[model samples]
Target: MPTSSTGSNPGYVPRAAVRRRRPAQPTRARTDLARLATRLTERDVWLTEMLHEHKVLTSHHITALAFTGHRTANRRLRELYFMGVVDSFRPLRTAGSAPEHYTLGKAGAELLAARAGVDLPATGWRKDACARIAFSPTLEHTLGINALLVRLAANDHLPLWLSERSATRLWGDWIHPDAYAHHGAAESDQLLPFFLEYDTGSYNLARLEAKLPGYAALAATTGTRTPLLIHTATARREAALRRRLAEPADRLDLPLATGNAQLADPAADSWLPLDSTGPATGRLTLSQLSTHWTNVTPALTPDTTMPTTGRPTTLPWRPIPPRPPADRT
Candidate 1:
């Protein structure tokens, strides 16, 4: 039987030449966080930050916490509440008929607590801190991102810092990033050493291209040492992610296989990926647990209620101003 001459013809289309369409961008049902400039004064932002930072607040009790002025405190309380950044103050405390204490809601606290971890079921302190941190869906997102950050920080492969979404607060409508990454920003105080962001799902390159100008502007304000990083490692969506990784803007992208990945210490000249059995090819995952998590979330049970008893001592952010050098004669 003679083969079809058409198969040998130059005009015949190869099976691989079939038409292929571009992959659709991943969609995330993100929230719209309204950050009105007028909503809060700088003092208000500071107070809100403090409230979220500690996950508890009492204006009457926090005279030396982070800022001064009752008016400032009142202003922040009103602004944070109005902007929906906060749910309600602790135990709904109030004076003269109105609520006073500034407590983070499930979302507000979680959003601001971006450096904190939120894996409640797996860890103990993390669950408690997250519970104490209060519930904020935005915060929840940030919590996940921060958790990843802490993990990265622990990796000997890299020295990571806070960056992108959490630091500059430009996460589109979704106040919190899906992950935490590093960025270099300028802060006179040493408390906020860096900035970073975490975003899950694949995004269109052109869309992010548009956000660069704004990101660049923010970067200019950050310190010289800051560098921005963004990561997405959803195992279920790796192929789509890999395509995005090929884009030009992805030069800074760091790859983590999530459960499939293992980070190596830089001192080691060789690296080994996990073997089929799931055991680390080179070193054990970790024999000892670490206590360096930035924040932990705890779920509220019947036993866990608003911490009762007496007033709690407030911790102040005081770093002795860097000592000036002394000259030797």
Candidate 2:
């Protein structure tokens, strides 16, 4: 593993990363007649759009979000991968089987652009770019964050999900969180807007700590606070992070909490607040987090007092099976 200046091990890049290459094959794995008859399903297009937006997603993430089961999702994904509409890779896992990670393939990008009446460049789809992302050191972190969002979507607890690409449009080149989201709508008008930091405990603690000033500056500019949720690999890492967070600093009044990888569910009541002086309270869910730490502020936009709820005017992709019927007799 290579180490960056920050002393954190670069994300795991396996030998397969450099060896994998795009085959000079046609875009359709099925016969021309079958392809013509079926064309592209709505779900197929939706999957591509998701990959484009999120950069990378595991097969399980896609299944939980789009299909009824792993078998169905896996079958479709394999077809798509062979058709050149999606690219996939399985990294080296230390333990059990590793899930296949998927990215937008060349044909998929073209399909998205055609559907949207936009050009290829506008779609930002490049075979090389997809390969680069697949091999990037931060690939694991990216997939981990997507997994969190997928779990939320599975429970219909995710009302809005803004990929880093969409978030960059608001914050520009500065202060890009892993993801910007609002915990699914609640009974109260409370729209919880926050940023997720899916730390792998790879980088130097000091380098990670250095990012605090940027968040503080972002808050100062927007005139509102944004809660940052961190999910780390271990309790020891979380403690070290909390200690660094405790250091005195001006205008850094942001609510912070830490969770670990061993957590069965990231959105469950598993986070420990940094500023809590009392003995450790139980874990807090995403919805409960906002209220649990009153000091944590909702994200804001610089131009207006509007909350950064991350809700798009139109949902980019529709969730499947729609929420179950309202108790129909």
Candidate 3:
């Protein structure tokens, strides 16, 4: 065949002269992940576990749970994020800087699976999935739950944190709490299990009211009424929810309370008994909830409602090793 005069078959564009878009190389994250495996520490492992359980967390929450200070948490988290051990996205905010919210990344999931001797799923977590949660309608509600956990974890009293995912796994589909938790001083002084309902003031009141009966039914079935605690965004929302709870038709014998989420410490003396008309001054700590509501028995150990197969009572990792003391010299 005769070539066109530029390289030239007439009007033919040579393949060498064709502008082609090269396929993007695999992300740096894939190759960088191997370094994370060798550099992983116990603290890093625990952070991954927390992200897996909670689904997402702000750096502040991660610091409160794992590190001694903000700077260290930020530094370590930045490293982990880049190494593909965690992924993060910051949601749009009209005022003030929004903190980056993080979730388990592929490497983190693989590390966890290896630590637990389980196979990692073929398709693990994706950044887009986590990013959607940061921008989702439930973002504020999820943060409210995180706020509660942060405060509880900071206190000297030992608290056990359980995510809604684990709660659903254990308790099945009947009632899905925003979170489930237990606060205690000692084995005997421990408070009963409780389910948290974080209200963002975005849902219909009737829908909120409808769930009360289900809670009551859950109480009856378990032979123990686990207090259903509602944390509302504002005092108005709290008041409105309280009024809804007070309705004669809506009232159930279940132990319930509502708290303003803006309070300094949600787990403290902010929860007011929904059934009380005396005053809000008698708010109780989470553990003290039992002291005020005597009719309801404490939740059974490993709640009877827990489904046999799905209950994951412990993290794949052991208790976080205590941080070594800094050298005084």
| lDDT (CA) per prediction | 0.32, 0.65, 0.63
Tens digits of per-residue lDDT for model 1, 81-115: 65545444332112212223445443344343332
| Steric clashes per prediction | 34, 3, 5
Residue lDDT tens for model 3, 1-329: 11111111123221211111224657653444456678977678777777777777777777666667778888888888766688776654333344557788777877776666665652245546665665565555566676676677666443556777766665554577787776665365446557888777778778778777877776777677777888877888888878777873235666788887557676578888876544455778877876666655544354234344343333342322112122111
Checking candidate 3 for backbone clashes, the offending pairs are 3-8, 3-9, 4-8, 4-9, 5-8
| Residue 188's lDDT in candidate 2 | 50
Candidate 1 vs candidate 3: the lDDT winner is 3
Q: What TM-score does candidate 3 get on C-alpha atoms?
A: 0.77
Q: Which stretches of candidate 1 lie over 4 Å from their true place?
A: 1-51, 54-135, 152-166, 169-195, 202-210, 217-225, 236-239, 250-329
lDDT for predicted candidate 3 compared with the true structure: 0.63
Best by lDDT: 2
The stretch of ten residues in a row with the least summed lDDT in candidate 1 is 320-329
Quick one: how many clashes does candidate 3 have?
5
Candidate 1's displacement at residue 275, Å, is: 27
User: Worst ten-residue run, lDDT, model 3?
Assistant: 1-10
User: What TM-score would candidate 1 get against the native?
Assistant: 0.29
